[model samples]
Target: MKMYLISDNVDTKTGMRLAGVEGVVVHEMEEIRNALDEALKDRDIGIILITEKLGKLIADKIKDIKLNYHTPLIVEIPDRHGTGRTPDSITKYVREAIGLKI
Candidate 1:
């Protein structure tokens, strides 16, 4: 399975590059839509790791993509300068999936 990283910040993009991500794309909002559209075409991409800030900015789009497509697990990871933890939206999904309250 392949992994992809997307971030708008240079530092975050650099960090993901240093981490040995085979494919990394740095994009602004307009570019992000096209990038995501192209990236989702890869059947081998099993994980899509996105920066928290960007994820929040495109939450609705992400949700729509998830509802439409079942592959390529979308994960919201904090940016390099960030705390590097799962965001609340992910946590909420996990909780709801397991029927837990927090």
Candidate 2:
């Protein structure tokens, strides 16, 4: 099993490349979708890392794939610009789920 990446920026792609993960950079929704489809077709790919920005462009499609398929686990990763999530989002989620503050 191998990990593949679909990034929105050259920096992210380059960074991942140094880690030995091969990937492509795409900016448009169509290109992102096409890249995702191509990644899905590869049986050797067990994980697909997509930048958060690109993932947002096709959130529904990714959700559907996650629900219907078992292979090629899709993950949303932050880019060089950093994460789009609020600083306390994970804390908030934990509190909401367990009713505890950390």
Candidate 3:
């Protein structure tokens, strides 16, 4: 299984390329959808890494894919600009999920 990336910028794509990951850079919603479709169709691709900016553009679609599919896990990744999440996002998520303060 291989990993594929869908980045929003050339710099992020270039960096991933250096790490031996192949991907496309798309900014528009249609282009992001097409890239995701192509990646999902490939049996060899087991993981799909998409930039957080692009992920926010189609959060509902990403949620649906994650809920329905068993293959090609989709992950939201930070781009060259860094993560959009707050430093305590994970802690908040954990607290929310288990109803416990950590």
Candidate 4:
């Protein structure tokens, strides 16, 4: 199984490449969708790393994929500009998951 990345910028792709992962940069919805579809078709790819910005841009589309498929698990990662997640995002997620505020 392999991991592939769909980054929003060249710098992020370059960084992932240095870490031994292959990826591409895409900015538009159609472009990202196309990249994701291509990545999903490859059985060898078990995980797909998407930049946070791109993920946010197509959250509904990605949600549908997550609901319909099990392979090529998608992950949202920060770009070279750094994390876009709120500091409390993890706490919020945990609260939602456990049905209780932390």
Candidate 5:
């Protein structure tokens, strides 16, 4: 299972490359869509890492893809600017998903 990264900046791309994860830096929605399409067509790719900013930019499309496919699992990660998520977002999401406060 190979992991591919879709980065919003050269910084993230370079960092991931140093970690041995190959990636492409793209700044537009069309480019994201194209990269995702290409990645999906690749049977070898089992995971995709996308920057938070670009992930938010294409949230709807990504949601649909996640629901429709089970292979390439798409994961959103923080970029050079760090995560855009609120400090409590994970706790809040966990609470919402299973009705737990912790």
Candidate 6:
């Protein structure tokens, strides 16, 4: 299985690069979408870590992709210069998983 790093900033890519993740791909919304589609076409990608900012911008598209594909596990992480987590994001997923508010 392979991992992918998707971000829109240079710092994020640099950090991932330093961490030995040479497959880091930096792109804007449309380009990111196209790149992700092409990457997902391959069967080796098991995890895709996306920056939260970009994820928010393309939430609908991500949701659609998730529903359609099962090989690549999509996870949202904070960008190098953004909040790592949000209360709303946490609560929403928690509520959906447990059927209760935390």
Q: Which one wins on lDDT?
A: 2
My TM-score estimates for the predictions, one after another, are 0.73, 0.89, 0.95, 0.94, 0.94, 0.80
Q: lDDT of each structure?
A: 0.77, 0.95, 0.94, 0.92, 0.93, 0.78
Arrange candidates by lDDT, descending.
Answer: 2, 3, 5, 4, 6, 1
TM-score of 2: 0.89
Clashes per model (N, Cα, C within 3 A): 0, 0, 0, 0, 0, 0
Using TM-score as the measure, which candidate wins? 3
> Could you give candidate 5's per-residue lDDT for residues 1-102 as a string of tens digits?
999999989999999999999989998789999998899999999999999998999999889989999888999999999999999999999999999999
- Tens-digit lDDT track of model 1 for 1-102: 878887767777777778777545555787777777777998988888877777877889899888988888888777657654556865788788998867
lDDT of 5: 0.93
- Which consecutive 10 residues in model 2 have the weakest lDDT in total? 25-34
lDDT-better candidate, 2 vs 4: 2
Q: Could you tell which candidate, 1 or 2, scores higher by TM-score? A: 2
Instruction: Put down candidate 6 lDDT per residue, 16-49, tens digits, no spaces.
Output: 8887664555566778887677768868778887
Off by more than 4 A, model 1: 23-27, 83-102
Q: Which pairs of residues clash in candidate 2, taking residues 3 or more apart in a chain or in different chains?
A: none
Which residue window of length 10 is worst by lDDT in model 5? Answer: 20-29
Better of 2 and 6 by lDDT: 2
Better of 1 and 6 by TM-score: 6
Alpha-carbon runs more than 4 Å astray in model 6: 24-27
Residue 2 CA error for candidate 3 (Å)? 0.4
Model 3: residues >4 Å from true position, as ranges?
Answer: none
